[model samples]
Target: MSLDDRQLLRYSRHILLDEVGIEGQERLCASHALILGAGGLGSPAALYLASAGVGRITLIDDDTVDLTNLQRQIAHTEARVGQRKVESARAAMLQINPEIRIDTLAQRADATRLRELVATADVALDCSDNFATRHALNRACVAHGVPLVSGAALRFAGQVSVFDTRPDAQGERGPCYACLFPEEAPAEEVNCATMGVLAPLVGLVGSLQAVEALKILSQAGNTLRGRLLLIDALDAEFQTVTLQRNPACPVCGHLTAA
Candidate 1:
């Protein structure tokens, strides 16, 4: 995809970077990203991906925008309250870059739909606020051999990680989301609606998710593959921990065995 004069000017900052020169910028302009959920996390992720010139972005969410979502879901507006999340987000993304394509799915991301979407996406982002949706997206990415950028935020804490199922040159596959948080684990469900999250925490984590997705798509730099990033907003601390793929993980373990 050759960048026209207008595109080159619009993406001049990215093209100026040595890591993301003309070639990397072009890669971003040709990549497709699938985003699940258009809430807090998806807001920044979608906004940045569009502003960065990702060619196509598909956003899926069944819910409608509410007054509460305005605290962190930046893609929505007061006028869009009660509108479908995917529609709200689509309008915001296109506002950033009208040249890019935005697909809005005002429906739940079920197993069948996720599998099909992941198969066509260059990268899939798990921006959903719940474990069920996260697990489903992870499974589809694993099955389709697509990279997954997962993010979550609650209270003043947040975490983001990238799970690339594709094997590296050494034939080693990175851990999937299930490897980090098992589906059967006795984990309590926490969300911004109940726990009261700081407005910027979601922005911090979601922005990181977008950064990782862009890096993976453009092959610009090393991503958080097999690594977890933890952010403590109250203490203003950041931590990165190494992650190992669980050979017994029900989702991606079979690939290792095969």
Candidate 2:
């Protein structure tokens, strides 16, 4: 696909990079991504993905914009309160880049829907705030052989990781989300509602998730395939923990036959 004059100017910066030249930018423009939430993480991620000219983006969120979401959910404004999250986010995305296709699913991301979405998407972003949702996304991605970028931010802490089902040149398998935290390792749910999150904290992590998503889609930079990036906003510290695929993971393991 040849870049038009407008696309050339719009993606000039990306085309200027050696890693992401015209070809890579085209690859990115031909890719599709599904974001599983329209909250803080999804807000910035969808914004960047749209601005970057990703071919298509599907946003799944059952929630409506709330007054409290203005703190970090930049996509939703005070006037948009009470509107469906997907509708609010789609409007913001179109304002950024109307060239791309934006699909809005204003419903909860259940297992069946997740599987269908994952199958069609080139990459999946787990921007949901709950563990159950995260687990469901991971399982769907693994089943469909799609890469997943999982990110979370609450209070002063944030984390990001990429789970690629495809192995690297070394022939070693990439770790899935369950590799970082085993299924049986207790479950806890936290969000900006109960524990406040800094405004820029979510933007930082969410934007980074967008970065990882693009890299994975274009096969350009080194993704966080086996490394979990941890960020401490309060003290401004960053850490990386190595992860591995768990052979005993109930969701990803033994299900290759199913």
Q: TM-score for each prediction? A: 0.98, 0.96
Q: Write the per-residue lDDT of candidate 1 for residues 1-258, one digit (tens) a residue.
A: 899999999999999999999999999999999999899999999999999999999999999999999988999999999999999999988888999999889989799889999999999998997888889999999999999999998899999999997888788899999999999998888887788999989998999999999999989889999899999999989999999999999999989632
For model 2, residues 1-258, the per-residue Cα lDDT tens digits are 778999999999999999989998998899999999999999999999999989999999999998989988999999999999999999999999999999999998888889998999999999998888888899899898899999999899999999986756865677788877776789777678988999999999999999999998777979998899999999999999988777777766664332
Cα lDDT computed for each candidate against the true fold: 0.93, 0.90
Give the Å shift of residue 156 in candidate 2: 0.3
Candidate 1 clashing pairs, residues 3+ apart or interchain: none
Query: What TM-score does structure 1 among the candidates reach?
Result: 0.98
Clashing pairs in 2: none
What shift in Å separates residue 73 of candidate 1 from its native position after superposition?
A: 0.9
